[model samples]
Target: MKTLPILLSCWLLLSSCGNNSQPAADTAATTTPDKPAPAKAASKPTILFFGNSITAGLGVDPEQAFPALVGQKIDSAGLGYMVVNAGLSGETTAGGRSRVGWVLRKPVAVFVLELGGNDGLRGLPLTDTRRNLQAIIDTVRQLSPQAKIVLAGMQIPPNLGADYAAQFKQLYGELAQKNKLTLIPFLLEGVGGVAKFNQRDGIHPTPEGHRLVARTVWAVLQPLLRQPMAQAQ
Candidate 1:
């Protein structure tokens, strides 16, 4: 009778231990840790530079172009924007209008338009040039409604006659006023008449000249970039 009681006590002790372990195992199985929250998608804003040979950096290294230089400034300043240099040599306002839709395939936070110089050089009718520029703007607005626009004003040599030159320069202001956009009056400001800044052809700017142009663009562009990336739209 004594041995039976001891065996019963031992059995009860083991059963109690097993019952305690079972609850712990059950709790572990039933109560899993909560899943971590999903990560947010990265949103990098794109600054698209749309223009002609000046933007293309003709007669100079493409990297030395004002647009690319602007990109360098953006990187240096930690602005964290993607700069798309969509400049094409020999592109006129009409040409830009035709290709703008294709270029704006992706989202754009800022749109820098630098065209109409070729139109002026070729003596194309100002009305046609204006219409083409307006069309390009319309296309940009349609595709990227939230994008900020910067109009690059251009000037032609006095050979086109003072009246024509005056009208050409005035057109950019008119466009900016009408569209309520930012304007960079005279893209080739200091480099235009300066012999050292321009190439042998007396047209396209040299690499050093491009630096000045980049500075000019950066002046207006830096302010826009100061806004948070989420607020760029």
Candidate 2:
């Protein structure tokens, strides 16, 4: 796939990058009832997109983020689901493990776990990344037994070693099979490694890139939503 070259470039840039500041949560729908709105809107089910910079829509308008685009598709289809962008920039699986509970304070019908990309990018221990991700999955299962979990798979260049890169790419499938979760094989399918789709950083997707991402995610998510929650478990 074109993922290797793109991610190799990303690794080079990220190696020299040191900032890890996190921004506020970006939600596609209003979670609070404080605003003036119809009761029906307030009671919609939530689809939480939790991940790092890509999920945060870095370098693009918030509305152009893939999660927001998914939210729009959900609305257009009258799916009656709210999309919550709980993505935090520069977050690793360890960080996600530490904060997932807080982000799950509200009820969520569909929980899309998009983390671990940073862990892979940094070439951290695959075991630790696996453990942290498992912890996050367990937490969601414990807290929301009926919620359907969706795993967003990510890949990295072999700069860290071919074996490591292969294992990292395989991690998501392993988790999904073990947990009976829905899987988005590759979150950046058509967008990754494409110059026009990526920003100058060669990492985060452009607005148009997010559009393709939204479609990739929606393809997996839409079918999952149609299935019975019990079946998804």
User: What would the C-alpha RMSD of candidate 1 be, to one decimal place?
Assistant: 22.4
Report the C-alpha lDDT of model 1 over 57-150, residue by residue, as the tens digit.
Answer: 8998667788878877887787766566788899999899999987776657899999999999999999999999999999989999989999
Taking all chains together, the TM-score of candidate 1 against the true structure is: 0.80
Residues 1-233 of candidate 2: C-alpha lDDT, one tens digit per residue: 00100111222232233244221122113322353222333355667788999998888877888988887787777676656677889999999999988776655688999999889989899999999999999999888777899999998878899999999999999999999888999999988889999999888999899999999999999888767655443
The local distance difference test score of model 1 is 0.76
User: Clashing pairs in model 1?
Assistant: none
lDDT of 2 at 225: 74
Instruction: Give all candidate RMSDs, comma-separated.
Output: 22.4, 10.5
What are the Cα lDDT values of the candidates? 0.76, 0.77
The alpha-carbon deviation from the true structure for residue 51 of candidate 1, after best TM-score superposition, in angstroms, is 0.8
